[model samples]
Target: MSTHDVKHRLRQLRGLPERVRALEAEVQENRQLNRRIAELTDIVTELLIPLEARDRDKVAEILERYKQGL
Candidate 1:
């Protein structure tokens, strides 16, 4: 290969580690957001049963727990 091509590739390689670290941080943030969404989904699912049954106490309790979690 030409020296110019070799030098270009080397420059790109030097930047890869920083790019990888930025991507890792983005992935970590996405994971945490996904986990929070799952938890909220579970809480909503749990709340639905009590709400359908017209059980005020159970609904209140579930809401209290959800609030405390936040």
Candidate 2:
């Protein structure tokens, strides 16, 4: 390895910290999005319970409750 090669490698590594920080921020955003998706999925599943049971009144009740919660 020559001095010029070592200097080039050092310069390349200089930006690694910023790159890692950007990637970490992206990962955090993705996690939050995934969590929101899971919560919506849960709400959808709950809403489907009444449909599966074929109870219109229960479905209406559940929908009202969900609306109030939101």
Candidate 3:
């Protein structure tokens, strides 16, 4: 309606693309972090079960798998 309002809207629109890209990058980072956390959780659980049963061979296997993942 007003000149000032129109200019302000245009400025906001100009910045929108950069803001969207930033948000997309942040989302990708979060996904990667979540995937890593899940992998770690699985490794811990595998180690715990083998260790509880005193299965050295199984524990070693699990550790090797974790190393390979890294």
Candidate 4:
């Protein structure tokens, strides 16, 4: 093609790597966030089990341990 077209294409190609890096970083961040959500969900479900059983002592103990962990 023409020189101008070639230069434009070259600039676009050079930008591709930076864009890919940003996208990859976003994907990794999303994975970490998803994992955290899953962990919290598990903890909540565990807490619910004791509550559903009307186990006040177990629930309190779990809450205290969880608070200390934070």
TM for every model, in the order presented, reads 0.61, 0.64, 0.65, 0.61
Of candidate 2, the 10-residue stretch with the lowest lDDT total is: 45-54
Q: What tens-digit string does per-residue lDDT give for candidate 4 at 1-70?
A: 9999999999999999999999999999998998899888877776655566667787688778767865
Which pairs of residues collide in candidate 4? none
Q: Kindly list the per-residue Cα lDDT of model 3 for residues 15-60, writing each as its tens digit.
A: 9999999999999999899888988788677665556766778778
Alpha carbon RMSD to native, model 3: 3.7
Give the lowest summed-lDDT range of ten residues in model 1.
46-55
Order of the predicted models by TM-score, top scorer first? 3, 2, 1, 4
Model 1 over residues 1-70: C-alpha lDDT tens digits? 9999999999999999999999999999998998889887876776655567667787788778767866
lDDT score of model 3? Answer: 0.83
Mark the regions of model 4 whose C-alpha exceeds 4 Å error after superposition: 48-59, 64-70
Better of 2 and 4 by TM-score: 2
Instruction: Report each candidate's C-alpha RMSD, comma-separated, in the order given.
Output: 3.4, 2.7, 3.7, 3.3
Candidate 1: segments with Cα more than 4 A from true spot: 52-70
Instruction: Please state the error at residue 48 of candidate 3 in Å.
Output: 3.8
Please give the distance, in angstroms, between residue 33's alpha carbon in candidate 3 and its true position after superposition.
Answer: 2.2
Error of 2 at 50 (Å): 3.1
Candidate 2 structure quality by residue, lDDT tens digits, 13-60 = 998999999999999999899889988797777666655766778778
Candidate 3: where is the Cα deviation over 4 Å? 49-70
